[model samples]
Target: MSPALHRRLPLLATAAVLVGLYASGGLLYDGFLSGRVALNLLADNAALGLTAVGLTLVIFSGGIDLSVGAVVGFTSIFTATLVERHGVHPALAAAAALAVGGALGAGMGALIHWFRQPPFLITLAGMFLMRGGAYWISTESVGLTHPLYNRLAAYELPLGGRLGLPVTSLVLLAALALGGIIAHYTRFGRNLLALGGSESSALLMGVPLAGTRIAVYALSSLAATVAGLVLALYTGSGNPTFGLGLELDAIAVVVIGGTLLRGGRGHLLGTLLGLLVFGVIQTALTFDGRLSAQWGRIIVGALLLAFILVQRLLHERLGRRRDPIHTV
Candidate 1:
């Protein structure tokens, strides 16, 4: 296989799994192949998709952000508290949430880069801090009864013939498109890829390491905040505990989407397919009355493990090929 095709093997595998899962669901469940079902898949996984999109960028730079899920939780609760208790407009509250998320991300990035700290440790601290902040804001779920919230929640764009796209789903698709463009067409994206591929090489090539590192984390946080906003609107409430353990799910989707866990390779579109694969499995389990939530998690865990093994094999094989004589 050509190098390009070889690199895309994981992405192709992800797409294949998605199609196979959906086909199996259609065969096993009534009305599973309908347009409505297809749209519902997007709607249900919108927040997750958004999170995965941001996480994909981070992974592309060979970094991880454990704080993503906590940031989502924090943003949801913080926005809710502002709107419901402080009589703040939902829009303004959301802006505040986004700003806070960005700041948190930047801070973590600074620590990781300037202090030469491990991304994992820094982001883990961020995770704890954000989660605690959410609890501080409110220990319970905050319900949104605002008129604007209700209107936005009910609004859906008509897609022909009884098909419609929810606002959250639309945002997700738009974000995905923007992310793709940024990843492929911009200097920052190139720097990010180079940084992930080899930080020393990137530095030698004169890439703006500090700015790129900080910006990627901040961008990831912004995405998490957006996911929180979407989740708040989708659920009609913002729970302080929302998105608990979701960072792992987002990471899993990014990895399953073919982005190397070690950094330096991946596509945003692949993450979308991985998200769909996850949604399909969960939805299918729900369709099966006999199956439990534990089974859904177990299946996803198994798939994630399988993909990790594949990635490891490919990484080693490709590494040797690239450095035939020096590789030992």
Candidate 2:
């Protein structure tokens, strides 16, 4: 393959796998290929899609944020409590949640950059802190009966008969669009990719390392907050345990989307496809009543391992090709 084609092969493979999975599902189940199922994929996985989008940015910047799921849990409970007990408007409460998430992300980023701390450690601490904070605020699920949430839950943009996209899905698409632009067209995005490729090279090239790192984390947290709001709307309540294990899911989606875990390369569109693949798997399991839901995890784990191995092989091949003398 030509160099350009070789570089794009992974993304093409990811897209093909997604399409093939959907096709397989359609072949296996009647009515699985309908517009309703298509729309439901987006609707059901909107929060996850949004979270993956944010995680894509962080990964592209050569960083990871394990605190994303915890932030989602925190935001959900915090927003619900604000609207439920404090008589705060849902809009304002949602804004507050976003602010808290952004602040938390910024703090973590600062620690990672200023103190030269590991992203994993800082984010793990953040995860514990946010999850703990949610429990501290309320140990139980807080039901949200706010008019604003009710209206949002009911709102749908009709596509045709029995197939309309939910408000939450639209919100997710909007975020994806914005994230796409940032990843592809912005200076920050370019700097992020450069940093991911080689932090020392990026610094020598005059990329704003500190600001980019902090911004990436903040953006990730902001996305988590948005997902949290959507989760609240979906469930009509917020629990301290909301979004449990979602961070792993988001990371899996990113990796499955063909983004390198070490982070020099990734695409927003790939992440979306990855999320679709995840949704398709779950939906397929649901359609097959005989199969246990627990099987989904096993399948996902297997796929994740396969993808990681592929990445490792590709990385080794590229390294050899780039340094032929060293390889010899």
Please report the candidate that would top TM-score against the real structure.
1
| Residue-level lDDT tens digits of model 2 in 1-328 | 8877776666787788889989999999999998888888988998888889999999998899999899889998999999999999998998899889999999999999999999999999999999999999999999999888888899999877877778889999999999999998999999999999889989999999999999999999999999999999988999899888899999999999989989888788888888988999999999988999999999899889988888778777876877585455
TM-score of each: 0.98, 0.97
Backbone-clash count (model 1): 1
Please count the clashing residue pairs in each candidate, in the order shown: 1, 0
- Cα error, residue 95 of model 1, in Å, equals 0.9
**TM-score of candidate 1 relative to the true fold:** 0.98
lDDT (10s digit) by residue, model 1, range 150-243: 9999999999998999999999999999999889889999999999999999999999999999999999999999999999999999998999
Candidate 2 yields a Cα-based lDDT of 0.90
Q: Model 1: which residue pairs collide? A: 62-263
lDDT of 1: 0.91
